[model samples]
Target: MNRRHLLTITAAALAAPRLCFAQDAWPSRPVTLLVPFAAGGSNDVVARFMAPVLEQKFGQSFIIDNRPGGGGSLGMGMVVRARPDAQTLLVSSASNHVFHPLVSGDVGYDVREVLVGVSMLTDVPTVLAANPGIGVNTVPELIAKIRATRGGFAFGSSGAGTSNHLAGELFRMRMDLDMTHVPYRGGGPALTDLVAGTIPIAFMNLPTVAPAAEDGRLKIIGVCTGERVSVRPNLPTVMEQGVPDFAVRSWTGLFAPRGTPQAIVDRLGTAVREALAAPPLVARLTALAAEPIVMTPAQTDAFVRQEYERWGPVVRSANISANG
Candidate 1:
């Protein structure tokens, strides 16, 4: 009575995993790429740009979900809790995933531990700008003014633990200044404050602040790249402005929840390489002035690690906190 039943149950148990794997079929359903910022933002733009191509490649709907809040912590937390299936991914940037976690005391997830990097999308160099009323024209003059004030000035960032925050903190440490960091919800708000005299200075992505600088609302003190950006050759870099070896570039990348199948990660990485290589996508990125970057999963992981190491000390030393 029991022998046949036992054999059947055992066979079924042995076949269960394969059945589940078959069911997975990688995006048997629509895939969601969570953009942890407002729509039309850089991360969102990248996600939207790639969505259709990914859908075409996989023959499934590729949806973009914009969950912007907590300076990117909110959407990140959602991704952290999502199933390890390949369907849910985070289209993220350094602001929240890398720098935010360093400064934020309790973000509920470590980016490196809970998410696996798929590929880096783009790289944007930082720019240090100031309100025209600050009366500073160069990095040296800015430093001198801060010193004269006994480090009394204040600067603003897109938000706590964002690239802007870390860049500002790095500049403060490198220059031995004592300016306070004011965190806003996004770069737009920070730039608004800078132009309105609510804050005297900011370190922001070049694209976000360049227009204001050109219009004379804000003055470009220096770029944070190792060399002058080709598009802005007239603007000197911080390295040439007496701060040696100081460079910061913000980037966006694709990541899946930890425990996702390596095969899925590799597949996604290949798709990313294909997307970036497309001439139309490349032209769009070029038009937006974003430098497209490609990285394998291993390379992306190592790059994220390097970023954490680079910014961790600055965040800790500055005591940057999302709550504070």
Candidate 2:
């Protein structure tokens, strides 16, 4: 080959890396994080608090685009179809991403195609609470009663394909009982109905149930985790209550469209971890009624994939769907 041609190829190869590095040093413009749920909710608050910190660190505005509809699917679909640019991202929850996939298969994006970035959030446990007037102070007792009755009892969830719904299903399957499933359109409605005695037992998320548990309006039977949470240490876990296999927790994480440069992924992952580790940041998240956790890009990908596989079959077997 001629010297001129060889030099040209060498320069091209070197320039390719520089181009990639340029992409890696992203957030040159404003970064948009799409929160699928509406504003003023739990997820919204977390996003609102973290946006300023991220903007300060990266020197780029982090804006939240609220697109609430279809049980958090509308916004997710928009982001999934967007360019695989590091600028467009999503803050998604387990139930919306995992359970929704099971119930609504037509969602525009495939779990395998979306790139999980980093997890900056986790929802506290929804205690296995029951009204004492129902004669069940613990999960086992509730299970025993439902079993003895041959699944005559009814339990409510936030909505179809929601985390609250899956929690009850997981418990029923674990205890080897046949409990009827009743779902409401949203958590607020479900909780109201539960307190009014329309549904004797239900599994709502932590902050929502905590007030009732403390006021003697509800009896917490167990937590749906591997270990008891420090927030409510006295309560036992489902595993601790003898259903060794029962475990479920609603969580959220940041994600980018697929094919984003790896360097951006690494940088964003580190930023999320550092943000969560900051004491003041953690304090703000706690005050917002959520937990801020950071997982590396690879770790987030593995966790999301595992959950999708695990719940895909569970939802199919239980015949849980978004359709009423």
Best by the TM-score measure: 1
Each model's C-alpha lDDT? 0.83, 0.74
Question: Once model 2 is optimally superposed onto the true structure by TM-score, how far is the C-alpha of residue 259 displaced, in angstroms?
Answer: 2.5
Q: Give lDDT: candidate 2, residue 182.
A: 81
- Lowest lDDT block of 10, candidate 2: 37-46
Query: Each prediction's TM-score against the native?
Result: 0.81, 0.74
| Off by more than 4 A, model 2 | 1-30, 38-42, 68-71, 103-108, 130-137, 140-154, 173-200, 211-219, 238-244, 284-292, 316-319, 322-324
* Collision pairs in model 1: none
lDDT at position 306, candidate 1:
93
TM-score of 2: 0.74
The C-alpha stretches of model 1 lying farther than 4 A from their native spots are: 1-29, 59-61, 132-136, 144-151, 195-197, 210-218, 317-324
Per-residue accuracy of model 2 over 43-157 as CA lDDT, tens digit each: 5556777789889889999999877666667777888888877788888777667777778776766765665555546565655667677888776788777877753778886
